[model samples]
Structure formats: structure tokens, C-alpha cells
Target: MPDRITLTGLRVFGRHGVFEHEKRDGQEFVVDIVAWLDLAPAAASDDLTQTLHYGELAQLAADIVGGEPYDLIESVAGRIADEVLKDSRLSAVEVTVHKPSAPIPLNFADVAVTVHRGRA
Candidate 1:
């Protein structure tokens, strides 16, 4: 298995949901991401250039979650996966988008969508 860098519990406000109120009043979304890539180069040289900068990754996810409104969490997950895969060093990525304030009538803890993508 390739080495992985994980970022978890990234919270951002987004206007994403199927309801009109959800769009008008934004809510918090939590995102988690795992990027798989070769870490040997960075380990050997101790250079930041050889590996994925997780800070940038977090920012990228925050931008997507905060930028646009998607009715489905699946689309959000897919978009995040697509953007993270833009890094050539990453062979694969797994993204999970959490919606804690979904419009479910019943009491629920959270709702989330997870997507896994690999270079084609």
C-alpha cells in the first residue's frame, strides 16, 4: 500500500442541501480526506516539495465546500476527489463529506458521503 496523508474534521460553512431553507441559511460541513502517494522522496530528502502539503489540501476542500451549493453530498465528494487528484504525485484519494444538520425529520447524528478515486 502507498503511504497516505490524512486530514480530518475540517469544518466549513456551506449552503448545500435540497431544501430552500438550507440554501438560504448555511450550515457547517465536516470534511475528511486521505491522499495516497509515494512518500519515499520526501523522507529521503526532507524536502517539502516532494510531498503533498496538507495545508493546501485543506484549503482546497474548504474552498469547494464553501464556494458552491450542491444538492447532493455525492457531488460534493466527487468534486473534492477530482480536485485533490489534480496533484500528480497522488495515485489515489478518498474523500468524505459530512453534513451534520441535514433536513431529516427524525433525529440523527450525521449524514455523510464518501468517494474513492484513482488516476485513470
Candidate 2:
């Protein structure tokens, strides 16, 4: 697929970390997603059904982030990729999970894990 649908800066609260306090007190998580699909069909037909609806994707991402407690951001990204690929219309998905409030002693901008999953 040449065309893509991108959703960025989707934030949610989650209890996902290895530390005990992190699991007890949840922190904010940010997610960015890009889905690959053939946009020509939807563009030519001018039909919503022919393309991936990003609104639904956003909601699904939020749900996944806020639902489970994973020790690694890799797990979070993998789960999101799995959900995004559920739609056959999407040939591929790139997911980035960011943990700004991670349990790190250093002063860093952010911590994130990005993963790509697809059939093509």
C-alpha cells in the first residue's frame, strides 16, 4: 500500500512498568500510529467503508493503553500493532509507544519503543 493513515499524540493513562510504585500509580502514555492501505479505492469510490477509519483506531489505541499493565513498552507497541492489523484493509502498521514518566533517574526527554507489523 502506498497511502497511509497517521494518528499522532494519542495520550492515555496506564499502569505499565517494572517498578512496584509504577504499577501502583499509573502514568501517562503517548502513542503514535501509522497504518498502510490502498487509498485509491476509497478515493475513487468516495466511500467511507473502503478505507480505514482513524477515529476508531484512536479509540482502540486508547483502550489498549489504558486497559492492561505491561512491563515493557515493546509489549504495548506489539499489542497495538496487532489491533491495527485486525482490519484486512490495512496491509501494515507502525506503532510508537512513549513513556514520558518512566522510572528513570536521568533527565531525559522521553522513552519510547516503535514497532512495525504487517502482512505485506
Candidate 3:
């Protein structure tokens, strides 16, 4: 949509995995969030008050994903998407969680989970 704001490459450390070792060891996670909302006021007046505070969103995302240990990244990602969409002003939200150091033997840059949710 025309009125969308995206925050990308947000990284955090958290414990999330199917295996106990990986869960206890913890890992680094990267988040990319996209929030869609009408920004007429913020666009016209250039005031931080009228738009979503990206810093606060990041903190919330990090707090949610990092604060809890889930067996699946999908769960983490989905929760983020729902949380972001909880804002009445936001019409849509997309959330991604990247796990850089997964337990897979083969080398890979990262493993990620992505989810999208909309306002009810």
C-alpha cells in the first residue's frame, strides 16, 4: 500500500529451538518488520507523535521474542506480527525472525520465519 513503514535488519539474541541444547545455548536473531498505516498527519506535520515509534516497536519485538523461549521460530514470528497489528492505527504488519546459527550441520547464513497479519 502507499502508506507503509518498514523497519529492517533489527537483530537480537534469544533462545529458540526444537532441541534442548540449542535452546539452552541461545542464538542471534534478526528481525525485519513492515508496518502499514495511514501516515497523513506524520507526513504533513513531520511529527513523531502521529506515526508509529519504530524504536518502541523494536523494543517490543525484541522483548517478546527474547523474553520467551519457544520451540519454533514460526511461533515467535507470528506473535510479533499479531502484536504489531494490535495497534489500531496499523492496518497490516509483517514480521520475520532470522536464526543465524541453527543446529544444522551444513553451513547456512541463517534460518528465518516470516508471518503477516492484519487488523480485525
Candidate 4:
């Protein structure tokens, strides 16, 4: 729980937005994930089976963002958090969904939603 594996700036294109134009045209979404788990086992055993594979994690996040259409980035974040937490090895997960091309009709660097979920 004290140690974590983090993946940042994983970008993918998705058609997720409120407006029709936004959904049809699609936009870029960036995701950052922090998975909290005991690293000692993996380190001592020197086996991938003892830890979560980041490549698989990234693919799962990409598939969720690219496959589904959600009106709120909150929902997207929630989904990512939920999926990542499926692994029993993970004690908790933090997911951030970034929306750079949001339809705000104003100047802004980026918009994002972050969610944290832990096992019950």
C-alpha cells in the first residue's frame, strides 16, 4: 500500500461529449493511473505474476475510453477506476481522465476528472 505503480499521459481518441458535433468529430483523451499494491512480492520473487502488468493496464484504459461514449468525464474516470481495481492485488487505484478538447468556448489549458477507488 505504501508503494505504487504509475502510468501517465496515455492518450487516445474518443467520441465522448455532450454535443453532437463533439461526439461525431471526436477528440483526444489522456489518462493517468496510479495502482497501489505491495511491490515487495514482485521484487523478491522477480516474477511478473506477482505484480500488475502496465501494458495490460494501459490497453484496458484505452479500450474503455475508445469503446464507450459517455457524457461526463466523471463517468469515464469512474469506469477506469473500476476496471483497474478489478485486480485483487491492487489495494486502491487513482484514475485521471483528461479532456483537452472540451467544448468550453473559452481559453483553457485542459480539463480533467480524477477518481479514487479502494477495495471493500
Model 2: which residue pairs collide? Answer: none
User: Residue 116: error of model 1 in Å?
Assistant: 0.3
Lowest summed lDDT over 10 consecutive residues: which window, candidate 1?
A: 14-23
Off by over 4 Å in 4: none
Better of 3 and 4 by TM-score: 4
lDDT of 1 by residue, 47-111 (tens): 99999999999999999999899988899999999999999999999999999989889999999
Q: How are the candidates ranked when ordered by TM-score, highest leading?
A: 1, 4, 2, 3
In model 1, the Cα lDDT at residue 12 comes to 96
| Candidate 3 or 1, higher TM-score | 1
Q: Give me the overall lDDT of model 1.
A: 0.96
- Give each model's whole-structure lDDT: 0.96, 0.93, 0.89, 0.93
Q: Model 2, range 38-112, lDDT digits (tens) per residue?
A: 999999999998999889999999999999899898999999999889998888999999999888899999999
Scored against the true structure, residue 31 in model 3 reaches a CA lDDT of 94
Best by lDDT: 1
Clashing pairs in 3: none
Tens digits of lDDT, candidate 3, 1-120 = 749888889888899889998678898889999999999989899999999999999999999878889999999999898888888899899898988888889979878888989866
Give the true-structure RMSD of model 1.
0.7
Q: Which ten residues in a row have the lowest lDDT in candidate 4?
A: 15-24
Q: What is the lDDT of residue 113 in candidate 4?
A: 92
Selected candidate, larger lDDT, 3 vs 4: 4
